[model samples]
Every structure is written in structure tokens, then in C-alpha cells.
Target: MSRKFKKVVEYTFLILLACIFIFPLIWMVASSMKPEANIPVDMGSIQSLLPSIVPSEWFQTYQELFSRFDVFQYIFNSVTYAIVVTLGSIVVNAMAGYAFSKFDFIGKKVLFGLLIALLIVPAETLIITQFTVAHDLGILNTRLAVILPMIANMFFIYLFRNFFKAIPDEIIESVKLDGANYWTIFWKIILPMSKPAIATVGTLSFILSWNDYLWPLMVLTDSEKFPLQVAITNINTTPPVYTNQVMAILTISTIPLIIVYIVAQKYLLQGLGGSGTGIK
Candidate 1:
């Protein structure tokens, strides 16, 4: 085949793959717009996509969601958890990463190895232990129960360590010559240069905190204190599972994440690229 033909074929394949990935989201938005009775009944056919055929309940689903749940409170809870966890993760992970990268301590390698080993252990394995600990601490059913366990993410630590490791030793040495401490160097120099990694970790942390359901469900029994995802699920499981309402909840819940990714896309890409390439 000609070069142009080969390029066209490659582009076609990629578009098809993208469509496969994106179809569920499209279907979700479409279902949210559909009438409540028609959602599940609509078959696996393109007829659902026809704007004319699917009666647009543009505001009805949203209205129902608002009336049924304390949407703003749930959103506030989600935002509060996400922000707190993200900020805490950044500090803990960055400091740990910086130590691993720059400091020459006994067992540094061993400790890092242990951290890497933790990646293989599924989070589900620790849920029971975590719950017991929370109960012992008298923090269960509080927001602290949700935030405490997730504050130190291994992946973010690895990312920050790698990024910091790439920084020249000369930078630290020069700062030390000015009688600056490690903390000063980190605060003044290292952090300013680590925005990409910060953004990457912050975005991931926010998403994890925001979408979390099971752990929060296990801990928080009060509807007033539930995060958005848990609240949405609770609202979803009423006498009748209103399909449109569920879809609407999903769509609305997804919007903030989408906006965050769009805003942080550039930094995320930079962070991943830098981490992969060893942070030139």
C-alpha cells in the first residue's frame, strides 16, 4: 500500500479504538437525557442515539437528583475529602521521596524496596485491618477515617522520588553553602521545580478520594456525612431504580473529574513523561 493509504489505515484503527473506549460515556450521557421509563428498555441499538426519538428530560433528572439528595452537601464532602487527602499526600509523599532520593541513610534501598513491594499487595487485603485500626482510634464514621488511610500513596512517592533524584546534587550543595537546610532547599528550590509531578499526584489523589465508595460506605453510616459517590449510590437504591436519575448522577459526578483532567492535562502529561524518562 502507498504511504498515504497506510497512514489512513492507522488513523482508522485508532479512531475505532477510541470509539470503543468512549462509547460507554456517550451511552451514559445519552441515557441521562432519555426519559426515565425508556432507559433500560432502550435496546442495544442506535435508535437511542436519535435525539428526536429519545424525549429530552433535560432538567427533570437533575431536578429529581437535587430534590432527593442533599447534592450540595455531598459535593462539599467530596471536595473536602479530595482536597485534604491530595494536600496531605503531596507533603508526606514528597518528603519521603526527597529523603529516598537525596539522603544517604542506612536501609534506604531496603525501605524503598519494601514500599515498591507494597504495590503488589491489593488494597482490599488491608481493608479489615484498617477498619479495626480506625475503630480502635475512635475515628470510625468520621471524615478522618476516610482521609487517614489514603494520605501516603506509594505511587506518588515513587514519582516524586524519581523526579527529585533527577535534580542535580550541585543544587543542594550550593544551597547548603548558603547555610540553608534540607527543608529550605526543598521548599525554595525543589518544590518550585516539581509542579508537574505535584499536579499528577494531586489529580490522581483527588480522583481516588472523590470516587471512593466502598471504604466510605463501610465507615460512614450517616447519610448527612456521606461523600458524593456513596450518597449517589444510596440515592440510587431506593424503591424504584430510576435509570435516568442514576445516569444523571453518574454524568454529574463525572463532570468535575473531567474538568480537573482538562485543566491538568498538560502537567499530567509532563509528569508522566518526566517520570518515564528519569526527569531530565
Candidate 2:
């Protein structure tokens, strides 16, 4: 086979694969724009991938969702929760990473080893224990119950630690020699240099907090406090479940995540690349 022909074949295969992956998103957006009755009728056809031509129908599903559901409140709660958790995770995890990478405290090695071991444990396994602890602490049904448990992800801490390990000791020593304290060096020097890691962690943290349904659902009973993910599920149980509205909610819920990924794409790639090299 000619090299040019092989390249074409590979490109064709990849395009088809990309289409297969993207079809669902296309169908969703398309379906969300359609009327409830038209959705099922259009399924399994090319029309399923295209939005309704009627301009009024374009936003009718979303209009009904907003008017009927307290979607804005749910979005606000989710955004608030996500932001708080993301910031807290970055600060706490990065500090832990920096300490592990540069400090010489006792039991550090053992603690770090345990932390690394935690990476293998599935988060689902700890949900019951986490719920028990939250109940004991009287934080259940509050934002703290959701935010506190999610803020300390072991994988993120591991990522930050490995990324910090790649930094040269000489730079830290030089900063110290210039009369900078550990906090000063960490906040000013280390953090600024770790933009890629920060972007990666922050983006992932936001997504995690935003998409978290099971934990929030288990802990929170108040309808008003429920996040977008939890509240959206209520539509299924509520009478007159509209498929178009459900698709609309999902489509809307996905926007923030897509925006985050797009904005952090460059740093995410760089961070992942740097992390691979930094792992010792």
C-alpha cells in the first residue's frame, strides 16, 4: 500500500471514531431543541443530529425547564459549591504536596506512602464512612457535607506532589537565602511556577464538584440546597417528565464542564505531561 493511501485510511478511521463519540452530544443538543413529541419521532435518523428549524422551538425546552424548575437556584448552589471546593482543594492539596516534596518532618515518608496507597482505593467504597463521619459532625444536609468530603482528593494531592517534586531544590534554597519564609516561598514562588498543575487540579476539581450526584443526594434532603446534578434527577420522579427538558438540563449542565476543559486544555496537557516526568 502507498504511504499516502495508508495516511488517508488512518485519517478516515479516526474521523469515524470521532463521529461515533460526538454523535451523542449532537443528538442531545438536537433533541433538546426539539418539541417533546418530535424527539422520539426523529430518533435513529439523521434528523436526530440536527436541531429544529423553527427558531421558536430552538429554546422552548430550555424555557419550559427554567420556568417550571428552580434551575437557576440549583445552578447557583452548584457553582458556589464547585468554586469553594476547587479553591480549597488547590490550596490544601498544593500545600500538602509542597510539604511532602520539600520538608523533612518525621513520619513524612510513611504518611506519603499511605497517601499513595489511597490512590488505589475507590471513592465509592468510602462513601458510607464519609457519610457516617459527616453525620457525627452534624454537617449532613449542609454545603459543608458536600464540599468538605470532596475537597481532599487523594489523586489531586498525588498529582501536586509529583509535580512539585520536579522543581529543583536549588531554587528553593536560593529563595530561602533571600530571607523568604516557607509560606512566602510557597505562595509566591512555588505556586506561580506551578500554573499548569493548578489549572489541571482546579479544572478537575470543579468538574468533580459539579457532577457529584450520589454524595450530595445521599447527604442532602432539602430541595432548595440541592445542586444541579441532584435537582435534575428530581425531574424523573416528578409528574410529567419531559424528555426534551431532561435533555435540555443535561445539555445545560454540560456547558460549564465543556467551557472549563476548553479554557484549561493547554495547561491540562502540559500538567499531565509534566506529571509523567515528575513521578519518581
Candidate 3:
């Protein structure tokens, strides 16, 4: 076949793949527009992508969601958690990463090595241990339970360390010569130059913490304390004919993530591109 034909085929395949990936989102939007009784009768499986034959009660699903739960409160809780986690993770991980990158100390290599090793350890393996600690600490039902663990993550630390490593030693040395302490160099010089990396880490952390369902389910028994995903779980357990409400909830849940990604796209792309692209 001609190269032109091959190019056309490749484009067609990619377009097909994208459509397949986005169909669920499209269906969710369609369902969110649907009336309560008209919502698709999905049995907790992968929901149907096909829109209902007739669009009906657009307001009731949202109405029911509002009545049963203070969605504003849920949104506030999610936003607060996401913001707190993102900021705390950045501060903790960036400092750790900077030290790991720029400082030479005894056992530094060993410590970094341990973090890399822990990366392979599934979080599920530690959930029970974490639960025990949380229960013992009396923070099980509070926002602290969710926000505390996220303050330090191996992956974000690694990203920060690597990003800091890519910065020239001369820059740090020069900053030090200009009467800057380690904290000053970090806050003023290193961090300003590392916006893309920080944004990347912050965005990912926000999304992960926002969408987190299992841990929240385990820790927060109070409906009032629920995050967006946890709120959706409660909505999921509602009576059988809740198609529209489920769709509405899912739609609502997806919007924050979408907005965040859109706002951070530039930084996210730069951070990802820089990740493994650096020369030692």
C-alpha cells in the first residue's frame, strides 16, 4: 500500500481509539441531561453508552442530589482536601527532593534507594497498617486522616529530586553566594524555576486525592465528611432506579478534574516531558 494509505489508516485507528475512550464521558453527559425515570437501567456494571430514547427530568436528579446531600459542602470538602494535599505534598516532597538532589550526606543514597524500592510496594499492602495507625491516633474520621498521608509521597519526591537534579549546580552556588540560605535558595530560586515540575506534581496529587474512594470509604463513616468520590459512593447505594442521579453525580465529579487539567495543561506537559528527558 502507498504511504498515504498507511498514514490515513493510522489516523483512522487513533481517531477510533479516542472515540472509544471518550464514549463513556459523552454518555455521562447525555445521561446527566436525562430525566430521572429515563436514566439508563444499568446494573452496577459498565454502564451503557447509548443515550435514553427520550430526555426527561434534567432538574430532578440534581434536585435529589441537593436535597439528600449538601453538594456545596461536598465540593468544598473535596476542594479543600485537594488543595491541602497538593500544597503539603509540594512543600514536603520538594524539600526532600532538593536535599536528596543537592546535598551530600551519609546514608543519603541509601535513603533514596529505599524510596525507589518502596515505589514498587502497592499502597494496598500498607492500607491495613495505615488504618491501624490512624485508628490509634484518633484521626480516623477527620480531614487530617486523608491529608496527612499525602504530605509525603515517594513518586512526587522522586519527581522533585530529579527535576532539581536537572538544575545546574552553578545556579545554586551562585544563589548561596548572594547571601541566600538553603531555604531562601529553595523558595526564591529553585522553586521559581521549577514551576512546571511543581505544577505537574500538584495537579496529579490533587486529582489522585480527589478521586480517592477506597481510603475515604474506610476512614469516613459520616456522610457529612464525604469528599466528591465518597459522596458518589453513597449516591451509588441509593435505590435501584437512580440512573439520572448517578449520571449527574458522575458528571459533577468529573468536572473539577477536567477543569484542573485544562488549567494546568501547559505545566503538566512540560513536567512530563522533562521527567526522563534530562541528561546526567
Query: Which parts of model 3 have CA positions greater than 4 angstroms off?
Result: 1-19, 40-57, 266-280
Count the clashes in each prediction: 0, 0, 1
- Write down the lDDT of every candidate, Cα atoms only: 0.82, 0.87, 0.81
Question: What lDDT is reached at residue 63 by model 3?
Answer: 81
Candidate 1 lDDT over residue span 1-280, tens digit each: 6999999999999999998998888878877776776665675778455322635466677888788878888888999999999899899999999999899999988988999999667777688988898899999899899898878878888899999999999988988999999899988999998888888888878877887778999999888888888977787787677877787888888999899879877766644532233321
Which residue pairs collide, candidate 1? none
Best by lDDT: 2
Model 3 steric clash pairs: 35-57
Tell me how candidate 1 scores on lDDT.
0.82
TM-score against truth, every candidate: 0.83, 0.87, 0.82
Ranking by TM-score: 2, 1, 3
Candidate 1 regions with alpha-carbon error over 4 angstroms: 1-20, 38-47, 50-56, 266-280
lDDT string, candidate 3, 1-280, tens digits: 6999999999999999998899778878776665654453642334445455444554656887777768888898899999999899899999999999999999997888998899877777798999999999999999899789867888888888889999999988987888899999999988999987888898878877887778888888887789999888787886663767778888888898789978987766654532233330
151: Cα error in model 1, Å: 1.1
Tell me how far candidate 1 lies from the true structure as C-alpha RMSD in angstroms.
4.8
lDDT of 2 at 271: 44
